[model samples]
Target: MTPATSNGWLLETRGLTKRFGGLVAVDGLPLAVRPGEVRGLIGPNGSGKTTTVNLLSGLYRADAGEIELRGERIDRLRPHEVSARGVARTFQTPKVFGNMTVLENVLLPALAALDRGGHRPRSEILEHARGLLEVVTLDRQRHALAKELSGGQSMLLQIARGLMVRPIHLFLMDEPFAGVHPTIKDIIMETILRMNRAEGVTFLIVSHEMATLRRLCERVSVMHEGKLIAEGSFEEIANHAVVLEAYLGR
Candidate 1:
């Protein structure tokens, strides 16, 4: 049995597997993310990187294996249940309430965080929501409709919403740099790093932008055919034979 120990790591998945009909989308995989660490997951298309994220976030149920977040079993819970446990995630395609104002979009989740019996007043919740917008540099856009924001602004809003929840421990972000302008990408990167450093939140980032991942993550895991084949620092994975072969198909 995998020992239940926090050990400063925020997440640990052992023998995680998922199958879609006859196809195995995720093979037996074991992965861990330490608190305040920015870990990257990378692979060719359909290598199960996103599937792992889905499973971790409770968007999809795993076929087998255990998922422990801070030493607690959470593999069988629903998405909201997972979120309530201090896990929040953003998708490859950002999902925001387009009909709502930017402040409201973020405020909803923050408000939900209060549903579990909190004594704070409503004004405090709204202030916290605005603070998250400030962190994402979107405080000026608070009253703007979500659909009025540009692509990069939309992505930032999604991230801010995830963080609006009080004490969000880990964020599983998928393709956060996708469709974002270069300058805005830097803003997003800075936001993530700053949040991790300042608040001690952990991150499991799944991104195709290799250069950005290299700059951000302390360690990276490479996957192929639904299995993690290589894991190391940026320099090590760049020159790894198997990783090169997986990318080069040699």
Candidate 2:
């Protein structure tokens, strides 16, 4: 895939800076994600990867910066407001409602964001939920309680739930493969690629798994000590001396 230029970016963050008390978490970060592009964010611990996601998702207000989703400024919006604007994200831990059935969890987003004329009938919503479950290969467990699912299954369900929002711009995924098994990890990765290709869902994935990130992302951004120190294709980041030292102590 070609790199997203400034003009065609679906999501753009300019001078995005965030701070917690005296500690700067994300410093003057600038990023652009194109429609349908899967960009990876990789950095060592305490590199502000999760902090950046929080800021973008409106969990934390930026001390400075601007975030635009499809050219609309959204940095100051509340989390739910951000969601309503077509931005969806999955946390590192599955955030599904534990007491809800798998299908119910998937349907919640759609129900919450129902607009005046766009609301579907109950039967149609159920069918749509089932289709989302099928996309994640979780239709077999659609009737099960969310809390009963394994870690990997819960992760897939989280992604499916995010899709229920019908996002058009971006999906911010935080450490999606952190604790998943290799087989399940492959399933999730493949599903992500398929979604990007089939539905034009842009992604900004944060992960420590270099191999997985390299395989899944066309471009990568490396953060360290609250700063975005590098941004380029995986090969460029992998070969950078600073990145090598950051990952492997000199």
Candidate 3:
């Protein structure tokens, strides 16, 4: 268990650092996200937002710092282990199994969990998977091969798959709205909000869409050169001088 002070945070990191041959991709960073909060992480390209997500998701191991989820250290776990711990994430680019049907792609995670001791009935799991497809507006495409879908549709598939991982504690969404049509973007945003409000799911969303962040996030954190520069409500961070300088320059 973490110290009492950290109990309030669903996810927390301290002095988080990572480097690729001295590039210092993530440098001495600290982050905290409260339970059920939709928090936005924004920065210019190469600001370490995705790198941070990768570390937290265990795709890339950290060189320094610790990651705690509900007070247990998870930074050392493997990717599958992290997922088993109830951390799920979407990537900047949609990743799907081209050969698999859309419904099969969504079913993969839950089926994997069962292999690892999850006891949910197969019938119930299948029904839940179909329901998630409906939420993402992809129910009609359930029979199509994943590779046959458009880029936007592939993104929706990725989200449904991510949500299929049961017992999700925190969801790390990276650039979910990028290149998506406005209508599809609204659907994605609504799905996120619905899950957050109805399921009390926590999210750490990394996005560049300022307007969407303003609408979906209770608070936003700004990063520059691998370090956090500002954090506050959208209105507060929007007016922050340091944040402006980082994005617009002097």
Candidate 4:
């Protein structure tokens, strides 16, 4: 298959499929996200939303299909290789170094990026890391141990860490708003908007928060039992019979 050079998509998957023994986690899933777009991926439990993010972020390999970013094939790349190619992501559960300080958590990615041929000096990296913490409202806890952070704070730190990677082309955020306080959720939403509007970052957000998704996503795609069942605006999706049935059931 050729690179994703058409359709003006920053990220695209064609016939993307994954399986575990006889259980197909993601089946022939096709997805597309354009540059600077806040796209939502939502579905009920076990609908393959997280699995699709895993495939895109290089955490899981696809058994069949092509994954492309900016016309470059990335499905075969390793996790770090994918990050080096400008794809970054956060997990469904906050993943941070519990023993490390909040600032350190964010700083580590910058140092790693430098090792991978980044040109910025250590001082600049530090500044950038601090700036991101400020954006996520974690500057006050910069010196605190990551493990000390509350669940909501940990999610904020994850966002800061994800942003620490320079030149992030696509950020796949999995369940970003799940279980966070309303205030923290607002901060996360604001940060997403700020990144997308000011820096032109593209986001594929996976969340069950339909209300928040309606406010944040320009478009949305729905998945069910490993297959995409619908794609459109929130309005169209809300009224879609298939979507309603998938969530509400027969």
Off by over 4 Å in 1: 1-8, 115-120
* lDDT for each residue of candidate 3 in 1-250, tens digit (9 for 90 to 100): 1123356988999999999996998998899988888999999999999999999999999999999988889999999899988888999999999999999999998898899888999999999999999999999989999999988788889889988877887899999999999889999899999999888878899999989888999899999999998999988988999988999995
lDDT of 1 by residue, 149-187 (tens): 998999999898888655578899998998899988999
Question: Which is the winner by TM-score between candidate 1 and candidate 4?
Answer: 4
**lDDT by residue for model 2 over 1-250, one digit each (tens)?**
2234458888889999998889998999998877788999988899899999999899999999999887789999998788877778999878889999998899887777665345567777778789889988899999899999999899999988887665445789999898998988998899788878887788899998989988889999999878888999987887899988888876
TM-score for candidate 2, please give it.
Answer: 0.93
Clash list (residue pairs), candidate 4: none
Local distance difference test, candidate 3: 0.90
What is the Cα-based TM-score of model 4? 0.96
* Candidate 4 lDDT tens digits, 32-119: 8888889999989999988899999899999999998998899999888898777889998899999999999998877886787888
TM-score of each: 0.94, 0.93, 0.96, 0.96
Provide backbone clash counts, one per model: 0, 0, 0, 0
Off by over 4 Å in 2: 1-6, 115-118
